[model samples]
Target: MFVAAALALLATMILTIVRALSGPTLYDRLLAANSFGTKIVLFIAVYGFLAGRPDFLDIALVYTLINFVGTVAVLKFYEYDDSVGGDYQEDDY
Candidate 1:
């Protein structure tokens, strides 16, 4: 059962990669990348269980946190277009 789930996750990850590569917009690609990261976490957890290695869970948790932070940072960068100098200018909309 675990093996089957792992395989399914792998397939879904592949599809996510394809979507990330061929997405029509930046947001679509970002969504796909986030999904791919989630699938990777699931895959790692499942594989760890199947292989009887409990340490993998810790690694997966850490990876999940990193992925979340990275996604947020990228979104913030795109949204504000700000830099470390704090010279943010409002868009003239």
Candidate 2:
């Protein structure tokens, strides 16, 4: 059962990779990348369970946090056209 699930996840991951490569717009590509990261987390959890390694769950959790932060950062950067933060305007006294 776990083997079958892992295989399914692998297939989905492949599809996500294709979408990420051929997405029409930046948002589409970003969404695909986020989806791929989610699938990876699931795959890691399943594989860890199948392998009887409990530590993999912790790794997956960390990956999930990173994925969330990265997606938000990318979106923010695109939205504001700034990697650091909002536009900066020098004060005129």
Candidate 3:
């Protein structure tokens, strides 16, 4: 059962990657990326349980926090369209 759940999560992660690549808009891509991150957290936790390693849950939690922060930072950068005192503009990229 655990193996089946892991396989399903892996399949969803693949679909999420496809959506991120082919999204019609920036927001759609970002949403897909966020969803992908979430799936990763779930996958980690489930795998940890299946492997009987409780320590892996801590690693998954840390990853989840990092993912949330990284996503917020990216969204903020896009919202501002500039970084480092307006010296760096989005179009510059």
Candidate 4:
């Protein structure tokens, strides 16, 4: 049933969180976070259906996209910093 699926995804989300926290490297943590975000989108969609709320799906979709973009941006920042051999700090001046 949908409840069972939702529970399964919830477990996966928890696992992903652990992975993100205990990851050995930056890439590993990022991968875990990305996977968590993806699982969250699935969770929200299913939850919305079970609760008879279709509008939630739209929000989930937007969140998913934003999560993906944010992850990519963070990863890029890290990668750039690594290549530059220094931590990045922006100056608004």
The TM-score values for the models, in the order shown, are: 0.84, 0.84, 0.82, 0.82
lDDT of each: 0.86, 0.86, 0.84, 0.83
How high is the lDDT of residue 54 in model 3? 56
lDDT of 2 by residue, 1-93 (tens): 888999999999999999999986666688999999999999999999778885889999999999999999898887677444334334511
- Which wins on lDDT, candidate 1 or candidate 4? 1
Instruction: Name the runs in model 2 displaced over 4 angstroms.
Output: 82-93
The regions of model 4 sitting more than 4 angstroms off are 83-93
User: Model 2: which ten-residue window has the lowest total lDDT?
Assistant: 84-93
Residue 74, candidate 4: alpha-carbon lDDT: 90
Model 3 lDDT per residue over 1-93, tens place: 888989999999999999999987676788899889999999998898778885788888888899899899988887786443334345755
* Full-model lDDT, candidate 2: 0.86
**Model 4: pairs clashing at backbone N, Cα or C within 3 Å:** none
User: What TM-score would candidate 3 get against the native?
Assistant: 0.82
